[model samples]
Each structure stands twice: as C-alpha cells, then as structure tokens.
Target chain A: MFKKILFICLLPLVASAQETIYDSFVLAPGWTKLSFIPPESGTYTLPTYPKATNGNVINHKSEVKSLYQLYDNKITLLNFMYTTCTDINGCPLATAVFHKIQQKVSKDPVLSKKIRLLSLSFDPKNDTPDVLKLYATGTDKQLVDWQFLTSSSPELLDPILRGYQQRIVKEYDENGNYIGSISHILRVFLIDQEKNVRNIYSVSFLHPDLLINDIKTLLDPKTKNGTVIARSAN
Target chain B: MKKLISTLYGMLMSAFLAVALVPTQAFSDETCMSPYMAKIVGQEDYVYVWTLGQVGVGDEQDKLVTIAVNPNSPHYGNVIGHVSVGGRNEAHHSGFTDDRHYLWAATLDTSKIFIFDVHTNPNKPKLHKVITNFVKASGGIVGPHTTYALPGRMMISGLSNNQDFGGRTALVEYTNDGTYVATYHMPHDENLYGATKTGQIADGYGYDVRALPRRNVMITSSFTGWNNYMMNLGKLMGDSDAMKRFGNTVVVWDLHSRKPKKVFDVPGAPLEIRCAWGSQNNYCFTTTALTSQIWLIYEKDGEWQTESVGTIGDPAKIPLPVDISITADDKHLWVNTWNDGMTRVFDISDPHNAKEVYTKVIGDQVNMLSQSWDGKRVYFTSSLLANWDKADGPEKMPQFFKAYDYKDGELQFKFAIDFATEKLGMPHQMRFGAYSLYAKSPKDGAKVAELSK
Candidate 1:
C-alpha cells in the first residue's frame, strides 16, 4: 500500500516530465519509443485546425450592413449553405440537427436564453434576405432567435468562403449542363457569449443528446475543462 | 395653375429622396472594413496552423497564423494575427489563397466562410469588408474541412454529413467573394445508419478531403465512426471516421468535368498526404494516414497509374501513421505517428520507389507537428492541456507549444505560457504560417523573462 501510494504520487511527476505535441503520431502510455495506433475505438480530445489567416469574411449571404448586429448579445447558432444544394444529407441533416437541438433545449429555459440559431446562406442571389428570413422562420417564426442571412453576390461572399475554408465552386456535367448545384460540407458551430467556438459537430453525426449536454457544459460556469464535451442538463 | 402644380410635385420628390437615402448610407459608412491581400514575399509561400474545431464562429473560430519572415520589415519573425468570420462553431483547416492576401479557413461545424484581410495591420489585424455567411437549406448546416486554393480563385472542401446512408459525402464550393455559389454532393453514400438504433447517423464519413494541382483531381478518405463512436464507444456527436481502416475509400473527382472520375480502394482510413506539385501537372503524390503507407498515383496516358512508394505501419501489430508533410524543397516526405512519438522521413524524389531516410523519437505523443520550409526545425503543440493547465502558479499553464531539432534529435527549446503571466486567455493552437525557404529557426522554447509588475 505504501509503495502504491508512492507510485501514485510520482505518476503525475513522471507524466509531466515528458509530453506529446502531435497526435498524428505518439507513444502509448505503456510503449517505448514509437508505436502505431490500433484500429480500435476510444474517446479522445480531437485536435482542431487553425483559424482563417487572412481575416476575411465570406459575403455569401445578403449584404447586411452588419450581420453581427442581426443577433445582438444573443448566443447565436449560424449555419452555412447554398441555394442550389440538393444534397439532403448536407442541408437537411443540419436543419434536422437543429430541430434535435431545439427539442432538447426548449425544456431548459436557462440554457435556451443564451442560445439563438441562425443559418447563413451559401448562395446569395437565390438566398436573398427575404428568402432566408422566410426559410428560417418557416413563415411562422417557430424559432424565436433563429435568423437566416445571405450576401448580395458571389464577389462579396468569396472571401468569406475562403476565410472559412468552406469550398465553393461552379458545377458542370460532361455535356456542360450547369448542374446548378453548390457542394459544401455540413457542421453546426455552437458559439458562446464571447463568440468562441465552444463546440462544433457534423450535422448528421450530431446526436441531439450530445448537443444538449454540450450546451449544458458551456452554460454552466463550474466545468473547468481543457476539453469539455457535454453534461446532463436533466 | 400648371406651373404651381409642377413646382409642388418637384418639392415632394426631393423630400422623399432625403428620407430614403440617409439611413442606408449611415449604416454602410459606420463599418465598411474590406478584406485586403497581404503582400507575398517569397514564391508560392503558404501558412500552416491548427484551426479550432468549428465550421467558423468567434475569436477562436476564424483565427489563422503564419510564420512571416520579411527581412525588410519591423515585424519580420513569426507574425501572429487573425480575421473574424461568420460560420459554424469550428473551423476545419486553414491555408493561403490568391497571392497570399486571402486566407482560407474551412469549418467542421458549419459551411459559413470569410475572406479576411491579413494585409492590414500585421500585429492587430482587422478584416476589410468581406463576404456574407451562407444560409443552408431551411433544415440544417453542413460540415466543411481542409481546402486547396486554385489559380482561377477556386477552392474545395471534402465533405461528409452522412445521415441516412453510408457516409454520403459532398464537395462544397464558393465564389471568390466568399459567397456560396453551389454544391457538388459525392455519389450519394446514403448509409449513415449501416447498423444503428437511430437511423439518423451514418456509419461512414469522408475525411481528409484535399485538392491536388494539375487541374481537376481531388481526393477524399473515409471511415466508419458509427460502430465505433455510436455503438461501441458512444461518441454520440462526433466524426465517425475515428476508428477502423477498411472503410478507406479515396475518391478522385474531376473539377471541370464535375464527375466521379474514379475511386481508389485505399489500404486503411487515409488521413493526409504530401502531393507536391512537381514539374508534372497531371497527378498528385501523397501518403495515406490510416494505412501508414505512401501512395503515388498520377494520370499518365489517360488511365490512373499507381504504386506504393513506402511503408510505415508495422505489419506485425499494424501501427498506423497519422500526418505527413513535404519539405519546401519537395525532396522528402515526413510522416508522424499517432500512437507513438515517432517520426520517419522518406525520400520521395522518385515517387514510385520512396525510402525511409530519417527516424527519431520526440515525446509521449504529439497532437500536431509543423516544420520550417527548409525542414531543419519542427514546432508542435501538446495533445492535452495538462501541460499548460498545471503551471507553477495558481492559474498557470505549461507551455502549450514546443520546438525541437530534427537533424540531431535534440530537445532544443520549450515554451511555458502562464495565464497569470501573459494575462491572455490560455494560448492554444500554436502554428507557423509562411517563412522563407530557410527561415531562421525561432529562438528555442526558452521562457520569455516575466515583465516586472
């Protein structure tokens, strides 16, 4: 018991003596120099990429004098999409994920106050401000803080797309018939009051429970975490 | 009577015009920041950094860094700055576009984007008037990751929002203005629920989608995160391409043709590769992550000619390799480990028959790794916050960033940041953007002397 206690005390010291900087490759807890990660599943604190270097915002949505003004002090959830996107998997899942987030958050009033949702249009011409407002509210204003946004034309939104690293391009088939489609990836960003990306998730992969739990973690001030994922609001 | 009526009409028209134009002009004039281009020094210089896990959101969302070393300037060493963007909560990857003035940051959260003006004040950079964030269909948002810039001011983000079917993926596109032009969905993979209780999630997800030079070809790899994260591991809301290797599928698409050109049966869940745009513009040469092997394939005489240049994962236990990068010289390909802190460099001069040249052990396991263009020094970040979260003071953080000498396998320097010291929000995502071919190595991780209170 004494020896075990001593080992426990020194464990952190030993761990602190050495460190790993890159996850792309590393030594396992019980390994010597280098080893390959096995083809198995495990929980992890996934690493994130860097922010946009150029400091440019894509002007895909309608040119609002100040898009940020659209949601003043509200914890807004902004989504990305184009008008010609037919991929249900990309756009539909994103909307569905929000539906899931809404279902879970509606019950928790405290959590809901700081949270608002908005969808930013990838296509400006078709996705005008009117179209976005109509699309987000569903003509009923079902969602209180939800808003959809778009820019004037492609030029205004170009830098914004590059800044986000969200790929956007014209589509043409073999015969050159404009597919009239815009292809993009799908994920929802959960922003905090300070406007930091607290949590990000692929729409389809986003489990409503997971999102709810994450919001709980962010809303609560007690969670001291280097990589906090979620909490049970219930 | 006619004169009096005409004069009255003119007066009314003038009054109406005054009311209409003032408000709009006032609002527009208040803030009209524009995204400007950062003057490029060296040839084809680009920056590399760790993007926050967001499609694009706040301070940490659209943030990007590059190592700028211009001998003629006051701020010549590593330049740290960022631009704000509107999009998802997490950005996927960041790179340079259009004469190095525009920075491209892809998000893992939403498809929102921005083109920041890094050319502004280097120290405290501000974005000029940029693009507007895109609004997805009435329903949901999509995920966008890693990008490749083109000459015609084009960009591509490999995608996977697999919901109904097997990791159905798409190729999202945008105009140079940061607007959503259109989307190119991958051949419908409609199989998110290969095996699940909630058929809403797909078992597969396409990952590491990247663009290669030589016109139209783009590549993507995928894995089945459903069974691993959802079923066995219970990662309800996460990337499904975390576990397993068999799901490795590399899809190469034609940009101009916009057709599913061909799908290569990758060995494992391919991660990243160093496809240096050599003298040849027809094909891309890169390394696959999940498989721990080097794959070289190029379009020669129409058909795809392929070959495995090198091997990484030990055949005995199948140790998988993670990230790979090519030196600025385009002479060697560097491969880093995922489970172990080991790195191997291979000579890819001859794309078909590459060989491991350098090997070294650095730490327990690194989360991210970066090297100078010349490949003499390496910079990386710790996988966990333990290093920084537990510093000497009450609210202290260990050095989140570290530097090492690759040639001698020496621990040259380490940086320990203190929330109490710098008084800045704990510094995370330490990255080097653009430096000259052989930029002077940064002063090793020696502790910066604390300022006198």
Candidate 2:
C-alpha cells in the first residue's frame, strides 16, 4: 500500500523548478489614495481610477432635502467620503475640501451657473443626511448647494466608491480593535452638464482657480483656464 | 536522408519534454522552489507532492481554503489513486491513524470531522467520505474541534460547544467508517469553572490530543489564552469564564490509563500542548494561544519544569494559532498560528533560543497541519472556527495549497487543490502514504554521494 501510494504521489515531480517572478510593492498610505489592502496584510493596489456614475440622486439627509431647489445645468464636482472617520485624510478632508469648493464655486458666477458640488459618504452608519448636511455646512455658511449622501452598507458604498475607483478598508490594531481608516478616491471628478465625468484632478490639484478653468472648458468648450483644469481658449 | 531523420527525431523529443515540464515546473518553482524553501520542509529530498481538490468551509463557502501536499509521500503512500484531504477553512487541526491510512479533520465552520482515503490517487487525489455529524449525547453538549484516529478501531475526539457556552473537551470515540461511537466527558470541577455562557464557564473543546510513549493525553487550553492576552476584547485574559476559570491550566487526559491530570498552569493561558520524546523522557512542548510563547514542560526534580523557549504567531492565512507537529527528528518544530499568514519553523536544537529558521505561507487560512514521514514538507488544511467562510457558500472558491522550500523561506508552489467538477467539499485533516513505489535499484539513500565521489 505504501509503495503504491508513493508511486502515485511521485508522478508530478519531474517539473523544472526554475524561473522567478516578483509581485512585490510598498504598502502605500491611505485608502482613497487607492492603496488600501485587505483586513490582512500585503501590498495594496488601487483599481483603475473608476469612471464616475452621474445623474443619479436621492435624498439621504433631511434639512438638506430641498437645500437646493434647482441644480443649475452646471458641472458637478464629485468627492467620496465617509463618517466615523477620525483620520484627517478620511471623511474630514473630503468634507473640508467640499466646504472650500462650495465657497469658491459660490463666488464664481460664471462657474456656478453650470456646475454643482457632490460629496458622497462611504460610511452610511453615522453620516445620515442630517449629519452630512450639518457636516458640509461649516458654522459660518451652510454649503447647502453641495450634496452629501450615504449608502446602506459597505456593500452599497463599495460599488459607488469602486465606481469612482476609490479604496477603503477597516483598520485594526494588534488586538483587533476597529480603528477607522476611512478614505476617499483622492481625485475629484469634474462632470459636465451632460452628467459625464470629464476630467481627473488629483487631490493636490484641487485649487479653486485651477478648478474654475477646467469647469470653464467643460461648460463653454473654449476659454482661458488655469493649472488644475485649464482650457486652450482657442 | 539519414541525417534529416535523426534531426527530426531529436526535435520531436525536445518538444515533448518542453510541453510536459512547463506548468509542472512553473507552479512548483514559483511556490516552493527557492533553495531557502527546502530548508523549511527540513527534508533532504522530497518524495512526493500532490495538490488536493476544492473543499468548502462549513457553512461559509468563502474564506478558508487550502491545498494538501504530502511531500514525504509515505513509503507506501499513494494507494487511493486520486483521493486526498484538504479544505477551505484555515486554523484547524487533524487526527491521523498510524501507518497513514485513515485521515480525519475538524472543520472551522461546523466543528465536525471530515474523513478521506489517502490511497485514492495516481496524480489527482481527493476525499471519499465526510462524517459531517460528529455529535454524541453527553450532558447536552455538541460541536467537536479535533479528532484522533487509532488505526481502524475507534478514534478519539474533543467537543467545543453548548447552547449558552461551549462544553468540555469531551473525548469521544469513532468507528473506522467515521461513525461516532461514544464521548468521554473530561473531568471538570464546575465549582471551580462556573456555568458556561459561551464556553464562558470553565472549559472548552480540548486543544491537542496527543499520544505519548507511555499513554494518550489530550491537552486542553481554554480559548482565552490565545489572542493578545485576549487583548482585542474589552476584558483581559480570554473570552469566557470557562477559560479563565481553568486559570490557564494544561488539562491532560491519559486515555490509556483513564486518568485525568491537570499537570501545569501558566500565568498565561496555554491553548495546546504536544508531547514528544525529547533527549529526556517524553518532553512536552506547548504554545500559549494567549502569549505566542512556547513552553518546555518536563517533570524534573519532583515537579513539572516549564521553560520558555521561543515565540511564533498564528498559522498562515489563518485567524488563530492551532495544531502543531514536531518533526520525527525533533530538530524542527512546526507551528500553525492564527491569521498569521505563514507557517513558522523553529530550529529547536538549542531550545533556549529556538530561532525561527524559516516560514511558508499556507493556502488562504490554515486550519490543521500535517507532515510527511520525513518531515521535510508540511501540509495544512482549512477550518471555519477562525472566521473561515462556511462550506457551500459562494465565497468559497479558488482554494489552494502552501508548499515551502525547506531550505529557503519561500513557497515551493501553490496549486488549485480545487477540482471544479467534482464539487469536493471542505478539506480537513490528512495522512500521507497509502501506497509506496519502490525505486528500481533499491540503493541506499546515502550511497549517492559516497558512490559518486
């Protein structure tokens, strides 16, 4: 019996065991940076920057229910975020950026005429529409023009984020505590009036003037733009 | 014309060799071929390597998955022709009968034993039977964590749960065909243990069931001793009162003598204890599922001397530390830790500082671990206890194996042990060598070097 077993087991051994392939890379920091890994360890990879899903809207918050009765046929600025996020890079930064975008867009008459701001929360738990409405509008100004939406679960949040090609995963300690590592897909989507995601702006490129130019090109097709999203003017 | 014919023949021969060797070498070299890998298996030469079929975790179809490899392929190791053992859940253990005939496994999801035949293979191997129901009537307890096969007679087993809490590590017996014979409830002092709310009382399914030179002793270490001093939870120590109630004691049951021995207790909880013939008498070495530290326990100077030697994490791709086996040579100690992502090897020649010489990541999450007679290549299976997706679930696809080059710390190969068409369920425990093919010359393994030089 043993001899028969050994004979049967040895059949696959004449394989030429050579050739090397290395699939190694550094674990980049943060999730939206598209470098989030599994609950376990190993290198993190962000899927191809997801093309944004536009024109879809639902009311997830209360007071902000009718915040903006009319959304001008303007280009929408898209940002993904989540609540229960304590890290500066997670939900806080996305909201803060949208807050800044709201201020900047409100001032630019020509830009505001054709563009809006959208901030979706990856964390559906804490960030109800009311909470998001409270969050988007700082103490001074209620950035009611910007919409903050939360999905039902990680399952729902996953596709929206992955659609926008964003990455996120729960962070844990040596003892397995669920420390939040909520993050966004760092790039802001510049969707045109057609609800088509047109331009990609890395997080660092989110300056107001630069964004103004990009919107100008998307809206008018011909104009003098800036460093973030500039047009040829021709 | 003659020259042309010879050339054509040579070309045909080379083409035949290329097609046959590519995939064979490809997977092996990628997963288990580094020179450093051989050292991990701790064997001079590998006799056999067979990848298994797909087996799901209990209810969880995803997560836990594995490929079983019998590197030392028994002297008579390939009898079943195409049947072997493997699974989807990681961090489980196994029970094999002597002579490598019957193999039994405890799954992570259902906490039941799955059985298989080792002789069922020529190249492709798989499991023939699964005894999903391992429950016996014993004081309202069910769910077993580990199993031990005593050849064709009856096998021993341990229980893991109750309605409110898990029950004692009750020892049970099973017939050769994977039938539950009877359960041997362990001796526990409820007064000392308290009522179990989730095995929260004073005990749990036994951890390690080992046979020593003198007799059989199954060691039980409450679950609380396994995780970060039970750090993740709000409380310290372990999950329930049963584990804490036991006070981190090593519960030993001598099956032969029918005697129970609470030999030693660590300041920390000890989950699993294995007894091997050390240079001294049967020296029992144990790892604290609680501390990640290994302890050397032996009776000396009229008392048990427990010495701290080394440290290791959970099994590769698994969530908790589990079944461990010391090589026949005892020079190498192999441990399967929880969610650790790799199988660790310790050179115990110097037990004082048992250096981690090498490691090999097993498939998905590792449940139980097994070894070829030579101990060069180690085999691991999956279990659902460590959050392994239960068997028959959608997520339980693409399960494979973890082969290490014993010499180099690298994966020798990872083959899809999953055979899609057969619909093989979760793999559990395994034993190698149902048939052994003799060498043509029958030369001594040591003669190659002497004769050549």
Residues forming the 10-long window of minimal summed lDDT in candidate 2 chain A: A39-48
Give each model a TM-score: 0.46, 0.43
For candidate 2, the per-residue lDDT at A177 reads 75
Per-residue lDDT of B54-156 in model 1, one digit per residue for the tens?
A: 2111232334444333333433344344443432234445545533445555544444454555433323334544433432531222445445444214345
The ten-residue window of minimal lDDT in model 1 chain B covers B25-34
Residue-by-residue lDDT tens digits, candidate 1, A60-121: 24344444454455555666775445443355445545654664566666666667776667
Q: Which stretches of candidate 1 lie over 4 Å from their true place?
A: A1-234, B1-48, B51-88, B127-141, B152-154, B162-166, B188-205, B209-216, B223-247, B281-283, B313-320, B382-399, B404-453
How much is B402 displaced in model 2, in angstroms?
2.3
Q: Could you give candidate 2's per-residue lDDT for residues B1-453 as a string of tens digits? A: 436533543454344335432321111111111011111112222122222223342332321122323333332122223333334333245544332334455553444455544333312334557665555343334445455434222334444445434435566665445544455555555432211221222344354554442222334444422222213333432347534533354555443323344444453545555555332344567776556777776555533346778777532322345556665445667777645545777887665567787776665556556564433345555542432333344355433333433434444553334423234344444433222211111122221100000
Q: What is the C-alpha lDDT of each candidate?
A: 0.43, 0.43
Model 1: how far residue A191 lies from native, Å: 40
